[model samples]
Target: MTKFVVVEGRTLKQAMKIISAIVERYNTIPILSHAKITHRAEGLRITGTDLDIEAHIDLDVVDGGGGDWSVCIGVQALAGIARAAGVMDVRIERADNAMEARISVGDGAAFYELQILPEDDFPEIGGKQGDLIEMFTNGMLTATLDKVSGSISTEETRYYLNGVCWHITKQDRRFVATDGHRLSLCTYTPEGGEPASRIIPRKTVKIISNHLANQNLKIYDVDTGKLDIVAPGITIRTKLIDGTYPDYSRVLPSRHDFTLDLKRDEIIAAIDQATATGGQRGAAIKFSNQNGRAVIERRSGDFGNAKVKTSTPWPAGKVEPQPFAFNSRYLRDVAAGCQGAIEMRMTEPGAPFSIFDEDKTMTRVLMPMRA
Candidate 1:
């Protein structure tokens, strides 16, 4: 029962690129490095996973003959072969119940072979996807993630912040991520779904963002701490992070008496210019009203000091804002995705404040550095 998968080299190459996102870079398990190529009546499906997430993409068939059996081949190696194959047809075949598999490229012009792992050995994250719990367009999903993912913490100690917390209620759909110092939250409207929540890992959010640019429709299956996304001929299933998201709303400031509206570009440019001389840890950014004009300043030991002026108008009768220092690293995180006029609001120099656009669909809260 020799099973085979024949697809165009270009198509295989494209599919491998998507599967590549799920392949774990550091894996001790031999089978984890290989992609399980399964032959079906419809076409060839290539699958890869890193235990936490499983991704698969289907390719158009060129020519193949055999029963539906799967063979695991090294993912990166196969991708390299596909890239070299060019416009040729890629033919992959294995003998029935055999360990060795052969890859035919360019009609016998070049051949590559490797000992394959059994399909049963390739682990898959499974879930019962009965319905599309939530339906969102590519742009919507990308916008939501981009607006919030920057705040996703990389610290392993507080594992809860290592991913974006998605909460779906009968009335609202929101995505929130925080790295302790700063927090970002975005709200969006989806087609429909039952009340559910999931902490999608940062790795999986990255994969979704990469594919969202080209995908038209994105389907989500969030149930029992699992998330399965189906898009076109691609499917990605990932285990949700098992942790309780902190009540972030409590820390978010409700109102700020002082406010400054600065253009999005100026905010980003100020952070970029100021943080250039900072060290690996973080740098302090100082903001204050200099003679009724808004000013940003950053001082580094050897690099000297940098300053930027913004068009934010100060209230004529209000008390001038005292010099306040904020971590440039946190500002950079939220400033990366901000758009339009960013309203900087705070009750005082030491209190937590928020920055957001006019519509307020997304908001970022940052705590200022102590004096």
Candidate 2:
């Protein structure tokens, strides 16, 4: 029989961090990436895995037993317990070749001998860290990535477009992400670290977003190409996806000749009204240049159709009436992102168009569908 003792609070946090990293990417198999807990004189070591994603946590709490014993437990249940448990002592024991956790939190005590899977079944994910750059802030990287990742494709077929693309300029410090539908690019100048670019997988981005929680983080070198993100008491190292992103500069309009300045709310209201008339699900927006005013029309198969005219229309120019139909949802997404006036640029009816703020700091592009 093997027994181990450790502080429940800090150890719980560390274990949860490792478990969460695997669980977020966990699949149908419960035992696939379950954590293995081992107790010795030093402390507790928790290991978790999901084939491609693997994590381990080492706790520094006092260890009572000089002997060693390893037991596998359900990480999901363990996480639930840790979230509710408080500062106390955790006594891990083995009885009848089974593992149990005798947990004490505050004035309450609970004993649970959870059925576990074989530790050998857990797959190992080879994680290597390359040259690492130190990140001192939290919200800056997390928030910027969050904004850009919004446009990432959820489709599995297009594997490359599924995550945020990290681009390091040869001279400037800028990061860019695009999903072929919408794009977000931002720049940051740091005092230190060499310029590097790598595509961060969607799962890793999500894990970082959930854990950062408005706290600062540290980036440490793991091996050669992989980096470990250390935040508070949690540490996660992820392998970067490799691919070549498309040239985004070509999509942007060199000269957006026609411009319309209208209240963000007003355009959103127009979209809503048009969408409602299209049907319950949604519809498309057809922009027609009728003389000076830009006529907006909505079409629906189940229901009927509706058209709404904008008050402050496009300025009179030599450009003739250009008609383009875009998914209503795509238009609304960009409109909701911007405040004040909405700027639209168009070169062709089916060609992609861009809607963004005047500052040009944050831009969203949408491709028009044939109506």
Candidate 3:
């Protein structure tokens, strides 16, 4: 229990801000509000969990003299201590009996004594795992989730849709989210893995998107409905939603009877301008197919009527598509997510419509509303 950790005060402060975010502000279990601190020759590792998700961050140490040790202390309080210390180096040492720890700055210029919880009481997701699967670059996983995050369902009744659904299609990984009104699907290449699917909770999706950047992660599917993510100095274990993800492929329109291509920025701007003059929330915008080359979106309000045009000819020899109406908010969100040009496919106004990006890695399905 003689091991101690020394780190720059400013560096400790920044690292604590990130790790403590994983610890809940309040919990009935005291240990759940604390972070597990482990120190070895290489550096210090700080970890926190909310039972469902566990994450850790590693910090380089200024001195590693007294061997290896582990302890648990209040995360929020530690961050406050570091902030108060300013640029001075901070040292942390555990009591001989291991029942408490002291965080000191500037040779006792400032110090705080905090009670320690049993390290073994801390919870982590651990179980028998199948073979670790192929690699997923941070850019791919984060970008895919960011695009679909807006469409993820927040309704409590059907809880499965509350997170992004990850699965394999043609050996490529696909992430999908929907709120029943609209669906967004993002595809990435995970290299190698047995075919499987899991619904990631919304909170976990946000945490991973924010912190796990620029590193390639290895994945493992555990037998207990949990997933493991491992990178060089980070490890995150998360529980998958226990429900089955809906079969979204059924909602995808089979044929591209008619396709209209437009610049991504142009369509989003048109959607925004047309809906600006609307009265209340949840306003619907109507898209009228005019001539063979143009479609007009117009919204009528008490002040005046607003009209904007997305002019692109229907593909040659295909039946002219009928005018369709959609929830303005949903359409604008899906359109804004496109990284490139928007290619829209439709059968009829009353039927399901599909939107594709120029690279074809992303797909969106929107249901039309009665105009």
Window of ten residues with lowest summed lDDT in model 1:
214-223
TM-score of each: 0.92, 0.81, 0.86
Q: Where does the lowest 10-residue lDDT sum fall in candidate 3?
A: 294-303
lDDT preference between candidates 1 and 3, better one: 1
- With a 3 Å backbone cut-off (N, CA, C), the pairs that clash in candidate 1 are none
Identify the superior model by lDDT, candidate 2 or candidate 3: 3
Clashes of each: 0, 8, 0
- Compose the digit string of candidate 2's lDDT tens values, residues 1-371: 34655556656765677576666445688676367777766567777766544556767764456477667777777776677665665555544444444544444476655676765665656656554465758477787666676677787777777677766665655556676766766555533235566677788777667666576877666664456777654557676665666778888776665666667888888888777744554366787766567667887667777888877576567865367787778777777767567777666456667776754456667777765
Q: What TM-score does candidate 2 get on C-alpha atoms?
A: 0.81
Question: Candidate 2, clashing residue pairs?
Answer: 128-226, 129-223, 129-224, 129-225, 129-226, 130-224, 130-225, 130-226
Per-candidate Cα lDDT values, in order, are 0.81, 0.66, 0.80
Model 1 residue 237 lDDT? 87
Candidate 2 weakest lDDT stretch, 10 residues: 98-107
